[model samples]
Target: MLFNIINNVRIICAKIVQIAKSGHPGMPLGISDLFSILWFYFYKINFLNINSINKDKLIISNGHGVLIQYVLLYYSNIYNFNDIINFRKFNSKTPGHPEKNEIIDASTGPLGQGVGIGVGIGIKNKINSFIFNKKINIINNKIWIINGDGCMMEGVSYETTSLCGVYKINNIILIYDSNNISIDGLIVTYFNENIRMRFTSLNWNIIGPVSGHSYYNIFKAYKLSLKSYFPTLIIFNTIIGFISPCKSYNEVVHGSIFNKNEFNFIIKNYCIKYIFKKKILIDNKIKYFKYFIFFYKKKYFELIRILNFIIPKINYIYIYTKNRYNCINKSTRFVSSVLLKNIFILPEITGGSADLSASNLTKNDFIGFFKKKKRYRYIKYGIREFGMSVINYGINLTKTGINFCSTFLVFMSYMYSSFRNFCISKIKNIFIFTHDSFLIGEDGPSHQPVEHLKSLRIIPRIIVFRPYNFIEVIICWNIALKLKKNIVCIILSRQNFINNEIKFYNVKNIIKGGYFVLNKKKNDLIIVSCGADLEICFICSKYLNKYFLINIFSIYSSNLLNKQKKNFKNIFINKKILFIESSNDNSILKYKSLYTFILGINKFGKSSNTKELLKYYNITKKNIIKICLYIIKKKF
Candidate 1:
């Protein structure tokens, strides 16, 4: 009976790939036996109360072979016949790469990111268990990661697996589908590293080299996983194209659609009592194995609220807002750190840094390293930026507090891949990027981030909140706390100086995104700025005011300003505008219709003091004043 159901599902899995003309048939066909045993037999799911929060998370690292997951969902009755049929089509539940949702655990398309996220889920569950369970271990739901050969090759897998070892994070079962084949054919030439030795050295317990075709063998591995001291990695020796006649155990079956004869032969050769239909009646064991997926549904999220934050955090921030002196002449990073320390008092608001805790100031006094003992809020991620980012993303999935991690802004380029995916999924993860721009001097062009600000700003759906001042940092952090569905990055400064403190008397005007910093006089020349370099804008505006009435416009959140198009556009229309930024971010280019001038750095910076670098890059007040004078002289 088990073989009968598995056989039918395997054929259906192959057919779905063939029908879509664009999906990997190999993984589903290869791991059908393991998947059947795992999902239908051992995986604990609840169909009745599907909103069970402490549910198991299944993250498929090799997202190209996403059709297999859709097949599993279809059989489990989570998805109907139509959803599977529309695979890889427009606006379909099952895309070419599976996106993270309620049932579909983590949105996985980028290789090994799923594994990284799985580690995060394991960390989250562990944190929850520590916080809520109190010696009982009630929140011990496992995070299952089904990864292919490609996922093993990806650096993120190694990065996360290493962290998994350090934390001794149990309740994570990584099922390695060792097919020996990928889209580019056999992985023998490139991926020859000893995976077993690698994982064992990383302190993960291994449960396989088990026969992937055998249902009971896979079942036993799942049973062994329950008692694992550390996170377990189950390596299943499976054939890529299990039974597709000519295409079986080959790369052709990976992503390519079967030919007419190949498709016909697969259907003819393999049939469950000659019944080739989408709907199949699997046995009761399979039917009863329903489990909850932790709340990824949009409507459910709407119904659910983070009341823990709503009651205290907003009011908590108001304390800082009222005190006003908390941000006086401080670096945005330093100010944010003060607020972050206060926020991290909440059990839900977890944080860490990518081995730059002292510099990033992400780790607070009370929050120590989250090690095997598991007695703190901060996770001491030692220099793995990509791993730190995706793991923090996984923590955000817990939907507890606005989870944050930090790295220098220059290194953000390393985290762009998984960070971009988080943006795509709209995960409410706060990634703090300090040392924004060419200002952090003595550290050469290598350390100084020139293009990072623009690079960060361009990511789709990502809220790059560049707080222009310490006061804005307070407001930005407050806004980030309340944001329901946005992946936020609060870019901050490393360098500090004491200027006469300026205050926004009204928080509402600051929240409007684009407000006039200095608009006392009638405006002739407009200088627009964001974040770290607003001091330059203010100085330039003051210097330029002698020739013409200068209006300094500050955009705290360009995303928020973009939303207010009418108001934003009205400020730049046919006006003598000059936009200045320390880095390559020319805010005026977006207002190309307005003919604005930019005094922003296009080239890299040099190893010197901030004063000299500013002068060298022509980003000083003198440079901005010259640009403003040029615009005034031209009278365009």
Candidate 2:
């Protein structure tokens, strides 16, 4: 029966290949036996209860070979064989890659995300089963990821793997499909690394170079993995397009469509034992789906109830009250910690820092650390920022909680790809970045995020908040939790500031895109700034007012101008706006017409006191006065 199911899956994959005319059909053909073992024997999947808390997860990190996943899903009775046959077609349930919202877990076309998300899911289950003592038995859920040489070679895999080892996430298993051939050619032409030794060094259990076509060997590997108390990497040596007569050990067949004649010839050679036609087989698959539906509906509502009970309540109170200072302190990290404590009621809220728990303020006294055989409140993701972010997003897919990860602002670049995926998936995650901007002096330019703020701002739908004080940081956190649609990047300062009587309404105004911090004085020029630069604008405003009669409006959101509003129009019309920032002046160049003059650093900063650095960069009160004069002279 299992072999028949596998044969049906192979036929479905072949039809999908014919439709898409593009995809890696090689793995589906080569690794069918391993997938059969995983789906039918080892994997603990309740198709009737697809969202069951204790269900196993399968991540296809090598998404180019999506046919394999599609075939497996089809055979597992998740969908009818027609869905697999219609793969990569418009309006089809199955796209070229797997999308979590569409069918399964998070999307994985972007190599290494599957493994990274698997690590994250494992981390989440570990925390939930251990800390809450929910006796959830959910942590028993295993994460099986089918990785490729390409995925293993990606830096993100290493980052997530290191995190897995540090957290001792034993439930996660990775099957590295060592086909040795990439699109270009054999991996030996461009790649050679001691993968087994490398994983061992990271404290992961290393399993075979098992024969990819052997179900018994694959099952044995999975059994051994279950006995181990650490992550397992099962390496499989196999041909890329095995059993295809036209393509013999060829990289060309890795991701190209086979012509009809070539496909028919290959199918003839492979389908000798099976006497099935595509049209007649469709009815049989549909009949099987009817049985599956009965099982699914029986368990579906129960799982839904469990999800509702555990899922964090989406609170909008924070949206109304922007006073984050009352809840926490001026530090962004501190605010995040406090928010985590208050919002622990939400089962889906899980987070970890990249080895900077002490400095990042991600660790709170209330949150416990996840230990071996004991899940803790916080995940020690180690120093793997890239992996940490990927895992954070993955945990989001478990439908169990909200997730987050933290690191130094400079290290954010390492996880840019994963961050982008987070935005794409619309995962409600808070990245508590500390030591924001050049305020962390002497760490040098490498550590300073001079352009990082603007770089993150470029990503569409990502909310970048640079709070001037602790209160604003709290407000930002609250706003982030409420606006779950976008990725929230909260930039924190190293120095502390007083949380003055900044009205929640004003902060709320800021969240609406942009708001005038101070009403435009009849005779004063408007001053605009964000983050640490806001303080400079405040000081510069006072200096400019002393030198010349001017009104200073602290503009927070630069993108606010794009919104059509009557009040905003009246504020910007025929007015002299002076924008001040500590970073590059070009950061606000797009709004040059709205501003009379832009004062900011155009060159790299030097090692010095924060004050000295501000002064050296000409971001001082004197420079502000000079720029205001220059704008007045140039315009008036």
Candidate 3:
């Protein structure tokens, strides 16, 4: 039966690649038996209840081998055969890489992320077990990651491996596919590291050098890993593209397409009859799996009840709003810290910064630090930006909680890949980027973000919130909570914002992404700004009040502003709009159709105070007034 399944998988891989006329066939062919053993015997999953919280996670870190996963899902009756037939087609669930909201829990394409993601899920599981009173380990599901030679080489994976060891995170099995072949011919050409020694030094229980083709060896490793008390690394020594005619075990066939003749030759080389039962019968057979069905139903209700408790009550928002109104003039991070203290009613809200908790103001006073020795809320992720980010995404996959990570805005580039993965996965996670812009004075150019806001804005489905004041922070946080699936980048200021009395401070209007602070049906000119720039706009508005009927908008999100209806967005576009921003990037230019001017710096900032930086960059009320006067004189 096992032989039959492996042979069927080989056949499926050939067919999918042949049909798509594209895709990496080597990894799927090489790792067929490993996947067969995983899904058929040990991997706990019911196709009918794929969303079961208790179901073990299977992350294909080497997503080039995604075809093997698709084939398994099809054969196991989790996905229809139609999905297989339409592999890599537009609108099909079977993309080249595994996408989230599908059978796969975490999206895996960019190598090494799945390792970090697995660690995150494992951490979440351990925390959840504590949440369930420690008596019943309801959320203890294994996070199985299948990483290839490429994944092993990636630095992100190594970082996560060390972290898992330091924290002693368990229920994580990282299977290293040591095929020893890369697109460049051989891994030994550029990569050489003692795998077992490295993992041993990192404190991971090493379980391999196992034969990939042997079911017994794989089973024994899995059994030993389950009984062990820490993260396990099972290294599988296997031949790349084994048992195929089209360049079998050849580096040249890494991502090569197979022609009909080549496909036929490969099938013939396998030389196995296709005698598996039909899909309909397979589906029916799974329904009769007594143990799987019972646990599926039990976990379904358990998750629902847990989610209900985790979701904050409506009154919390009201109370949170009231607290925001009473907030004193302070740095946005200080306000965030105060608000965090009041709004941590939900137990699932857990996270910490990369050793910038004091600066990022992410440490919730009520929630204790999440120590590895005990289950708590915050994780003191000491300076692991990349690891912290991927883990945040992983924790979100658990569906038991929401996670937020914080660091200096400039350091976002360090963890950009993880953010890209989050975008690809369409996971709802919060990222608090503090010390935004040149206003984070004296930290120098290295710590200031100039193009970072523009870079974050371009990512699809990501909401970049640059709140101007205490009220907008609350509004943006409210929106972040309500959003179903998106990455919210809350860009904040280091300097304290001037507390100007907001006219018509309706919090609901903040959802529109941009709202008029000086509500006007008709105006000679409009001043648009965001974050710390709002203070300049307020001053500029007063200076220009005698010369022109001015309208000012505190535009928090450029993406959200563009999303507004044409008539609504045109209100600002109809007038002569002057955009004021600290960064040189003219992101707000997209919203206006009229002849508009932007006041910003196109160069890096120097180490100085906020006043010096603002003046040096001409991001001042004086500059705003001069520009407005020049524009008004030219128009007249």
Candidate 4:
């Protein structure tokens, strides 16, 4: 029966390859036995209860081999075989990659994200297990991540695997499909490290280089992995395109469809003698699954509402800095620490650092370590900024109300792709980035972010708020909570300006894109700024008022100017609009011909004190005042 099932799955994989003409046919052909053992014997999944809190989660990280997963789900009576045939077709449940809503797990074709997300799920499971105890055994749900050598080669996998070891994620199992072939060529050409040894060093229990075609070895390995008290890595050594005559063990077979002769050869080698091509059975399985899904969705929504109610009742706060000055109070860090103290209600919000929690002031005082159960809130994500960002997204995707991740502003470049995708997916999360600009002295040019401000500004549908002080940081936190779109709230690590008189409006205005900050006299120049840079404009305005006798208006959001016609004209009419910012000047240039003269750091700065760096870069009050004086004098 198992052999028949495995043969059927291979045939399905071949059919999918024939249809898509562009997919990974290798792993499905090679590791069908491994999947069969997992699905039929080792794994426990209630098809009727797909979203059951205790149901084991399986993530196919090498998403190109989605046909393998599709076939298994179909044979296991979860989905129909037709869905497998419809792979890569539009509006089909089975997309080219495993999508979150479409499949049991979200897959990233970009590599590494699946493993990172799996680690986050493992962390979430552990927390849930501790919180609910016997009432709900969320930790009982194991996380199975099937990855290729390409995924393992990615740096994110290393970062996440190390963290998984540190967290002691016993319920997480990583199945490495060691086919040795990648898109370009053999993975050995580029990656020849001792993978098992590396994982062992990270404290992971290394299982096997199991025979990919053997059910016995695969089953035994899985059972051993389950019993292990640490994260497990099961390496399956197999040939690419195992049954295909011409392409077996070849790199060419990694991501292309086999020709007619090659396809026929695979069929002859793998298919049973009597079965050429079996017609899909239109059984009541789909109807039953649909009925279950309907009830599951209703239950899920009810749970969401319940969670929403519970989330607000729980006191949780996030403090962030976009400019260097806001780090002065250390109150943002203090507030975050306070939230971390209440471990029970705020268990869902996991804080992480890209190896800079101490520098970024992200380390909470009360939560010493997360090693023991229910002890800590901070997650040391190592130096993997990209992995940290994606893991934050994954944690949020788990629908646990709030999660936060942070690193130096310079490291945001490493996390840019994942962060952009997180925004596109509309994950409601917080990102705290410190050391925001050139003013971050002594770290030198490598640590400074000249274009990052402008780069982040271009991402559509995300609110990028750079608060000037601790009060604004608090207000930004309040605003960030209500935001549905992607937001990058930038806070300063230097200079504290206490704005006690400023009235914080309901954060609803932030959703509208931008709003008015100071209603100064209508003038030719509107000082447009964000983050700590806004303070420069404020200081410029004060100097201009004192000496230059020029009027300056503060525009909080440049995005708002593009939306409202009247607001744009009212803000930038017939005046020299000198924009003062500490980062790149291009952010203000988009409002072109709004009499904008952008004053900001155009290059990287050398390591020095904050004041020295600011002065050296011409970002000081004297230099800003000089610019204003020049603009006024030139106008006259």
Write down the lDDT that model 3 would get: 0.79
TM-score of each: 0.92, 0.85, 0.92, 0.84
| Model 2 alpha-carbon drift over 4 Å, by segment | 76-82, 131-139, 272-306, 309-348, 497-508, 521-523, 546-571, 585-594, 633-636
Q: In angstroms, how far off is 441's CA in candidate 3?
A: 1.7
* Residue-by-residue lDDT tens digits, candidate 2, 1-636: 556666666656766787777777777777777876776677775665555566778888877676777666655556686787777888787877654663466547788878998988887777656633231232467888988888988888988898788778898999988888888888997889988999999999999988987767877887898888889999988877776788858887787777888778766765444433221111113454445346556433444544564434545466325645363325445555565666655444566788898888777765666664454557887777877788888777776655677888889888888777777667768887888877777877778777776678788778777766554555576667666567878777766543342434464565555556555456546666666566666665666667666654444434333443665545566667777665563545544344467676566767777887777777667767787777766644
Candidate 1 per-residue lDDT, tens place, 147-180, comes to 9888889898889989989889988899999989
Error of 4 at 477 (Å): 1.4
RMSD of each: 4.6, 5.7, 3.7, 5.7
Writing each residue's lDDT as its tens digit, candidate 4 over 234-262 gives: 99888788778888888887777878888
lDDT of each: 0.76, 0.69, 0.79, 0.67
Residue 580, model 3, lDDT: 81
Clashes (backbone N, CA, C under 3 Å), per candidate, total: 5, 13, 1, 17
